[model samples]
Target: MILRQHGPQLLHHIKILKLKKNLDEHLNNLLTSPWVPENTFQFPARGKRNLRFQSQRQTLESLSDSLDIETSSKALSFLKSTLTSEFVVSLCLLANILQSTISVYKILQSPYCDLKSAVEHTEDSVDHFGNIQRTMDVKFSKIFITAKALMSQVCEEIHFPRVAPHQHYRSNYSTKDPESYLRISVAIPIQDDLINQLKCRFSDRKDLLGTLQCFIPASTTETVDAEPLK
Candidate 1:
């Protein structure tokens, strides 16, 4: 969902750049640039698609400087317009939040994952998300600061979008600061959706798995009643 919401612009920019005749050459130049890592421009499919986009973002940041104005001006312009402070900050927050979800997903996808472990991991994830939602102010402060530092590396400053004042005809939220505005508007809603979805998805399975745990020999004891199993 995060990718669906925030990825299109970056992806579009990348696609356009890919069509440019000089993009590859520029990227090759970037690979050898002493200021950036040797693999900075490499977009290998190492894991999930979301992680790939994370890598792509890093690649774009590194390549943005090397893009030839004559050959890739449109792509460079698109990158400049799209990769704003707000976008990068939001992306950082989403990436941090989704990392836990992705870890759980990978575990669940593994052939070795069992029902007991799956239930435990899912519950842990729910708790993790709950903690994030509860402590969003403190949590988002750190994330926002980290994002600001990251943006600084690219020579961009964190700028909040203008929020309209309260009006009878329209609904508006008056926030005292950018952190508060983002915490109220973006982080909270996404965390709420994620927590709710995890609970809804696992609620039934968790109960059933709890009941079925009795069948596992490691879960059984001499005092265990066979009546429930029957």
Candidate 2:
């Protein structure tokens, strides 16, 4: 039912998405230009494996210094360490996804009316997010969404303040600048049920709700209060 009602609006959002993709490409091109080339290298996968194994072996050697190390025994030790490193890395990657999902769930459950309020209410969200931007060597300027014309929750702008020097990434040229970022629009088909869910979640947290509600308006039961209803 929600999709049916917002399908046309979703199509309109696609146009904005295309524009976002183009903007991202342009920014990437500029950021990766000769003068501000992103520091990246293609390490041979095999070499990476070797280094992983070596690091593990060194760790084990330090912990178990009293262990007897014979010539053939050392070769076996190296193989075991390499396999362990591969397993550890794989597990870490999986764990990262799980952790990210949990964080998303928490943000959704919070009493913020929309994503913007949620960010502000939980300043930790921004701090951790800033850390991630640096570690991931990437940044997100904004997110855009479009709903029905009658919906009054559309955002005029989303702000990301300047990242502190310690928190800023090496490749980000605007580290000292007041945080330059791209803008994104979200044009998902919206529904009353979804709006109600958001409102209910934020019912107890009025202060935070104000900010969020500004971005995602409540779904009105009657057309009289609707923004663009005709």
| Predicted structure with the largest TM-score when compared to the true one | 1
Q: Taking the tens digit of each residue's C-alpha lDDT, what string does model 1 give over 1-230?
A: 88889798887687667645444544453344322354222222223333433444545544554445643455466567645755666777776866557667768878899877898998899898898888888999988886676666555677666666645642245777777776676668777998899889988998898787667788453476557655
Model 1's lDDT to the true fold? Answer: 0.66
TM-score of model 1 (CA atoms): 0.58
Task: List residue ranges in candidate 1 displaced over 4 A.
Answer: 1-22, 25-81, 101-103, 166-171, 210-230
lDDT of 1 at 69: 60
- CA RMSD of all predictions: 12.8, 28.2
Task: Tell me which residue pairs clash in candidate 1.
Answer: none
How would you encode candidate 2's per-residue C-alpha lDDT over 130-173 as one tens digit per residue? 46445432222111111111012221122334444664342223
Worst 10 residues of 2 by lDDT: 142-151
* Per-candidate count of clashing residue pairs (backbone under 3 Å): 0, 8
Reference-based lDDT, each prediction = 0.66, 0.39
